[model samples]
Target: MKFNWMFLFTFLALTDLANAQFSSGNQFFIGANTTVSIHGLVLRPTFNNTVWSNKVLTRSPDAIVGEPTASIQQVHTFNEPTSFSGLVGLTYLTGNLNGNTEDDLQIAYFNPDEKYVTTTGSTVDKTIHFVSKNFTGFNNSFLRITATNANSVLPVTLVSFKALKEGEQAQLAWSTSDEINSDYFEVQRSAEGKIWNAIGKVQAAGDSKAERTYTFTDNSPANGQNLYRLKMVDFDGTYTHSKIVVLDFESNMMVSFYPNPLTEKLLIQADDWNEVKSVELVTKQGNVIPMNNSKAGSDPGSREYDFRKYPVGTYYIKVTRQDGGIRTQQVVKM
Candidate 1:
């Protein structure tokens, strides 16, 4: 079921991918917009969307690899059920690593059963090159960067961080698999993704190998476009931030459609579906985009739409409530 890369010895920089498996490649470039949301562990890169392959899967690391006993600080799980035995390289920006000492960092590969596999990476200017050979391959393996301190290790293994509107307040929640020299987590809020103000803080586990859960409530969140991020601070005052979770209440409409620049799927959330009569897609040209993957979104208050089949353009989603109430939102598919 695997197809070899059409090009024998060249690397390609694709933005988005739906369904196509290529062979003879272990290099992935995550640009400024690279969005990695593996099982609620979201990493929205400072860059735009880059290449992603289903075969080469990645998710937040679980409790299996807890302690850094093998010269590995943390591991990022990828390639489930698919073994890798060659080159595995990741090129990322220096700003994203949150490193106190980038000179001590290098990429390391691990086997499926939490065993240390061998690989090394180096930095060049603001770009880091984690390119090396992996002699052994296993399913459900890891692609990790060696860490010199607690600041660098906190991010890759974060379990999940989410934000939601709860009745009249905004709720922020997150969890961690392992922590080192941890002090506490400060929940910060911003009006439009800048000028953040610390809203609340929660105690951390300091140094623990167990899973820890944390939550903070912002009773007075901004009216709309509220940006939330966790300022994870260690005891030494070193800190790192999590991926920003956006909650927009700008619209007066009851139904909420997420990710204006639609990537793979568009999620529509509502408080209640009992009053919702119908939902469908509309184009700017008054054309209808019939969805083959309709009825996709599950229990987010509404249905999820797989807009991949349609061409890249602007579209409108019309929601008709039972009592003749109507709302329309514009979305652009990238």
Candidate 2:
């Protein structure tokens, strides 16, 4: 059954906007060149997590209608029954109506209630074409079609990345919809868009239905403004980068030492002492003195250090985790 094409366009556009708000998986494609065509449309086999939708605009039979009008067509069957399917219409317009010339078309889908599911192996197919009916006879032309699933689709919405001051370190956090075949995410920082360096990597949530959250802390962030992004990598080795988010980090942690020029012992204190993993005493000549973990319990507060064994001049106290993470401070040896 066919309805007024104008009415259908309005209805579908509104539906798409509403679906995007609540949908976890949504994707769409637009074409401009006449040679462009959509080939295959595939939906995930586990229809439980996502919803699918389609819109097609064919060249109008009557040129008086101006540009062709779009409409929502009947849902067609895909080779896989579990997945949804539908036909997209094609038509001729005022411009070139040659059999080889292509027409513009778009198809989009979203999953309002998607729960991430892992597929061992899967594939899908679709078809797109342009047809014209004139006084002479009827002619049809096919357009090249492409298929993309949840894992490959780019997110239209921008997720906010916030920076927080954690002691002397800066932490970053962001969130995204569930993904599939996701290997890991690379965190990059840039002073200018022209050059960027990988700061760290976070393992992806893999394939999931629920909203996933990720966080990364910059242990050695440069002073002033910094830019950050997630370089998402797929299991197949393919990858896509995310938009840049900028952050400004200000460090204000105070470090103080007592018993000036002390040969035997030295005391250190800092406000907001959460946990101190390890304490190290390094000499001016780059020699590391003996150090140890001084916290009494699982969580440690501020404490004093014993430096009596070594002679005094100038030295560096490097507090680090037994795992090798280091935090440094300069001190004077008496």
Candidate 3:
């Protein structure tokens, strides 16, 4: 499956990587047409259960089957669908420096998912850095890595990220542009914002260049607050994280009124704005005032009530949800 054009998004920075060579005491599964040379660059796979890449790049010191340029490139064929990523360390003195300045260098790459050549790379002390994007659901494919002077772009361009609470689950939806595109999206969750765990993975549109949208659901969210972010991994091993999205899950918190002691308008927001059926205001004189979203230009998701017309006193806000549940909040319009 070939794409219209490969994206070359090679932005350079600094990141220390593993050793310069495929070190000793390591294992590799070299399939047909696969070659490796020592002295620089090692592609090793992680074998952890929860964090598995589904494959490994063999690190062999006694590897003597490939040409001298094996330090700068590796060609291999996969037997099954695999997603792998690793850093390659290439020095400038080894005759592979195609450009004098660092701006003219990039890793010319190819994989089953890519179908064509897209470039990405970085450098430190003239040392070239190559990391492969995760290849998802591609098999019997040849991966080619070489050196070149070109620009790269990420296949998928994120357009937006959003979150909302539905019935009993937290649903996250995101949109992307020109996604010729990613391998998969790992949905992550956090409680205290310090620790995060992978909750689910959504398969990417490995070969699409249209406006694409994807969604994931957290069926079991905490009672109060839940944090979410997307681990967006591309086919060539490049990865990035999306902005954090928060969803509040509550049972009794039907209505929330802000600026209790306000001189302006009082804003009323609900757990699910669409679920709100009606709103009522109670005055100190036991007078009932029917309310609508009075805040000028406020979105449909919020309700604004004009409290400036009333004098300073204790007032009450009553809200009825679509499910027939009701909650009232007391406010002061000072």
Q: Which candidate number would show the highest TM-score if scored against the true structure?
A: 1
Q: What digit string (tens of lDDT, one per residue) describes model 3 on residues 1-334? A: 1111111111111211222222122333432222222233333323221122333333222111111112232322223333443333333333334222344544444454654343443444443443332322323233434444444332235677888888889989998764544799999886434477999999888866466899988899886556677888877777778766666674465566776677888877776877877777755334567886475326445567777677787766667677655565668777
Q: All models: lDDT?
A: 0.54, 0.43, 0.52
The lDDT of model 1 is 0.54
Per-residue CA lDDT of model 1 for 1-334, tens digit only, reads: 2222322122232411222233324544444433332221123333232334553543222323322322332234544433333334343334434423444444544432443333344332334333222333233344433332222232344578888888768888888865756899988876534377988889999977777888888888666456677888878787767766656554445788887898788888888877877776765444444443557466656668887777897776766567655565668899
- State the lDDT at 100 in candidate 2: 17
TM-score of each: 0.37, 0.34, 0.32
lDDT value, residue 55 of candidate 1: 39
lDDT, residue 62, candidate 3? 18
Order of models, best lDDT first: 1, 3, 2
Mark the regions of model 3 whose C-alpha exceeds 4 Å error after superposition: 1-156, 251-334
Clashes of 1: 6
